[model samples]
Target: MELQIGKYTARISVLPPIHPKFRITPEPAAPNSTDGEEEQIEAEPISGFTCIIGYTSGGGEVSERLITCRSLRAHGTGLTIGAICHAAKGFRAFRVDRISAVSDPHTGEVIGDGSYFSRFAVKSSDKARAPSGGWGLTPSRMRTLVAGLNVLSFIARCDGYWHALEDEPLANFIERLWMRKDWEGQPPVAAILDHAKRLAPDSSIFFASLETIFGSRSSTRLLISSVRELIEADGIIQDQETNWVLAMQQHQEEYYARKGLLGSI
Candidate 1:
């Protein structure tokens, strides 16, 4: 994660944890359990932190709510969180690997309401389909694990922007970032283009994924900078976009100060 602090930058990396417990292999639910009874959990998540969590439904479906991270227990290769979903009515469990983002209920943005999401206007595109997987885990969780473990990190800041180009600048930026790090190793440019094409158009999902992989603060900087590039892709920065970036910049300052990362800056 890189934070543009005044004329300098604050760089930090939160490495992915290695564990095979990211899957969910549960026994078939008893037909009678829907009568207000709950499934037997392996264990419960430790209680007390109240926040919001984004959970992956059967497939590519996404749902968010203010939830209390209650108890945590090993599921498969990862863990399951016992939480109370606030959007609906009651206590429930969420796959740890599938959690999109967690944030302070009162003060923090729901991970995407900040500068990171101010770019890309919603396209009203048809919902993307997620591969089927049930009684186990959703396909999104596995992809999350893969991407987290092997991050094709992008490193770039405001360079040359506000220039007109009919070509795919964002796609080009993605390819160059990966190649510069040699992380994904020289895939044909076409492959990178395809990857970008397949990327989730929902900015919230992407931001949540980042928070799930990295920590909240780390994801904040990364999300903001990347979105900044996307916003400037048209070679013309709009008033709304510029204001959102400024708001995010201020958000980062208050955040770091709260965490003391800005004390000596």
Candidate 2:
């Protein structure tokens, strides 16, 4: 299966029920069960399996990856898989719902139904510990931060030249305002900023994503305040940047008003 996300395209393949490295163990039956009665059985935890997937990131970039999934955990209304991502060369948390497609790594067959992973559910505690620098953020919150950063990148590029002065404040702002202290090292801020430049010409997609991901009044307020600070960081506020921020604020206000939350933010 082929999926499009933002400007990237990925071909997804499906995994077969049985692979040489994959195994499933049935749950033991309950004690004192009647012989004629049907018994419910659950599959044991999924330890590890290699598969190919088209994953859409929080920043709206999509990439195909070969991953060895180590565990599954309940996340909000969906599931999160902890995996060793070959492309990233690190353990990462991937929300199951954001997996555009999954396929067999060897054969490249498409898993049209996407139901294979849903059958093996596990508690959040079962997930493997991520390596250092993992932000330990939920997928939704990560999306919000990424989208907000993209907007900041847009503002930095509004004057057609990115000022060197903006970089430090941008980095400091992200660490101080958004990240948790325990999250050991910095996020991929440089990569996100560079990627945002490529998408800056038409950044409405990010704004739309941000609107959809907005969770609370405080988050919205923080984003707007951050944008304002970024706009003044280089000692120059372009007309374009100011106008864009205003439009964003107006859109957010209307959004909350429509949801009967105008008074909250």
RMSD of each: 17.0, 16.3
Candidate 1: residue 99 lDDT (0-100): 70
TM-score of 1: 0.31
Backbone clashes in model 2, listed as residue pairs: 13-102, 13-103, 13-104, 14-103, 14-104, 14-109
Q: Where is model 2 more than 4 Å wrong at Cα? A: 1-136, 179-201, 263-265
Worst 10 residues of 2 by lDDT: 35-44
lDDT digits (tens) for residues 1-265 of candidate 1 = 3444342222122111212322212334445333231222111112223454556775877665555333454566656656445454345666766776654443443443212211211122413343222112123322333232122122111222122341255455444444443432343455433333222111112222333433344333334445556665666665544543553455445655666665211
Predicted model with the maximum lDDT? 2
Which predicted model would earn the best TM-score? 2
Steric clash count of candidate 2: 6
Q: What lDDT score goes with residue 25 in model 2?
A: 32
lDDT of 2 by residue, 27-146 (tens): 343464322211111112232345667778899977776665545767888888766455554456788888888766544566532345764453444334432112444433344555
